[model samples]
Target: MLTELWNQGVRNLVEGRIVLGPGLNVFVGGNGSGKTSLLESCHVLGLGRSFRTHRLARVACSGRTEFAVAGEVQDPHHGRSRVAVEWAGQRRSRLNGQWIDGHWEIVRRLPLVAVHAGSFELLTGPPEERRRLLDWGAFYVDSGFAGEWQTWRRAHEQRNAALREQDGKLAARFETVAAAAGTRLTGMRERFTQRLAGFLCDASTAGLREGLPAQIEVSFRPGWPEAESLLEAYARSRPSDLERGFGQSGPQKADLDIRVAGRPIREASRGEQKRVLNALVVSQGLVQVASGPQGLTPLLLLDDAVAEMDETGLGGIMEAVVSLGWQCLATTVDRGWAQRTAGARPDARMFHVKQGLVTSLD
Candidate 1:
């Protein structure tokens, strides 16, 4: 679903152009070359966020007005949608040749899955990381879910601050909104996990650890005592909450507990966590395309995520990827993997990237 990418002054990329095909697209590059930056550019152009440490404004050339990425997509091919993300100085962007109100709208078109070293955080980091894992799945399945998510987050913040400030009256009123929003967010999380777990069960799927007997499951639990209404819980926890300067209840404190084989991923072997991460990303992308907006499946972006896999692991992952007919952009340091993957599929396209330049190897 990515027509082409014309990146101008973004991160390591001084100015690089890439024209993509429908199947697997690989970017092969060495260390500081911009391999990851290209993938991050895809994400920023499509999602409005940078994957690396660079600031959004810095994504453009060091001192330029801003960086711009222009490309096309499926469904009513509207020529090229260009996004010029400016530093705080300029402060604006355009989509589909027309000026847009908010930058997020520009990001909807950029649905990318970038797995790098940080993926370890999925299992080793705080619960927020895991919560986000589930939410990405939810966002793909439910269109209105994002708006609900935003509302819930805002309400949660208001309620938490109120409770922290010891304003019982304000916290109580805010609790009403928070409670309603939490329930909705909780339900969405549940729905996404359910769909994801079911998809992994598909025999044609790839990347999951075979014979891992147990399945991937996610559950939501609030931080404090289980109460039917949040207002009641907040009232009960107020004394201690104010003592701690943070709300002890609601989605702010919610946790997404994920278990594979009846054992937590945090406790699982390092390899197991990697396999689980792969499985989750692959399965979610497949389902999103089958049932995302216009049923347009997402284009998978693996920024050097695969080179870490051994031969067998890579085989299983690629087999599933090919079987599902998903469009992908895989980055790697190994030229052999690039050769093999692109060689096997006639539609696959490969690019050689070094420093900041990109050249199609196909």
Candidate 2:
């Protein structure tokens, strides 16, 4: 589990670190005291990106151009691990310790899920983003995923550049590249959806089951599957894509049409969308433990995650954390939920935040 996280030069604060244990860790405080900032630091360190904004510089504290995060993990069952992230003088990132090479390498070694307000990006962002999320998790669960994805991505980039250059000859040369990548991406995604579906479980059994027992289905929508082969689709869509100024019909843009109880989640009520996202997250944790060698105690970062979820949704999430023996760090505007969560949890730590600092209220 994450033993501790140290952060500096982040929003609204000078520096801070909080020691953590295996269950629930709650950050409670007024709006601007950096309660959420601490969580953002964890989100940034773990995922290499912040859900709140695409820009890292935006989260930097006033007068500070750099930031750092340190985390310690102990695996009594296997071993221990420690890592730190430091970024100075720019919007870019800096790692202070031995680092993993690529973005996927970092995430695979450190698989952390951050579910904050931007969680809905799953429902709303480009299909490539959603697909990558699953692929990342798949890589975490299976090491071979990265090499497959990388090989395909390289080919796709070359082909896309060729298309942009309006060099049909070059694009044709890379058709095999697009087809291979598209097929693998599609297969990986299909298997993940099926696996998550089979794990169909309710968070309520652990006393957190709420909302409609979330129904989730993942379907592939190859933009032009019926009209052409992967290469043909690229050729067919190339002219219009260049006109649109973006590649519009590739695996890079492929999407999985998600639905909750037959309702298109994007068009569903706010409450429904939140529940579906929650279910996916919880499902993600369950899959991790049940499938990997690392058996990483699923780390769930809930930044303002509950406020938008219903009582059932919140309870369900908490229940899943406890049931799966996963670790959770959540933030809230009020303590009512925290208090209730504490009461329900036998092993949970609570932290009070004020202006970028965190104090454990045990």
What TM-score fits each model? 0.88, 0.87
The sequence of per-residue lDDT tens digits that candidate 1 reaches over residues 139-186 is: 767777778778877887887788778786776777777777777776
* Overall lDDT per candidate, in order of appearance: 0.70, 0.69
How much lDDT does candidate 2 score?
0.69
Where model 2 places Cα greater than 4 Å from the true spot, the runs are 75-78, 89-96, 124-129, 201-210, 226-228, 238-246
True-vs-predicted CA distance for residue 320, candidate 1, Å: 1.9
What does the lDDT come to for candidate 1? Answer: 0.70
User: In candidate 1, residue 327 scores what lDDT?
Assistant: 75
Report lDDT (Cα) of residue 22, candidate 1. 77
| Candidate 1 deviation (Cα RMSD) | 2.8
Worst 10 residues of 1 by lDDT: 75-84
Please report how far candidate 1 places residue 71 from its true position, in Å: 2.6
Best by lDDT, which number?
1
Q: Candidate 2: RMSD over Cα atoms?
A: 3.0
lDDT by residue for model 2 (189-278), tens: 666666666554543332332455445665666556756677777777777765654466666766667786777778777777777777
Q: For model 1, what is the alpha-carbon lDDT of residue 225?
A: 61
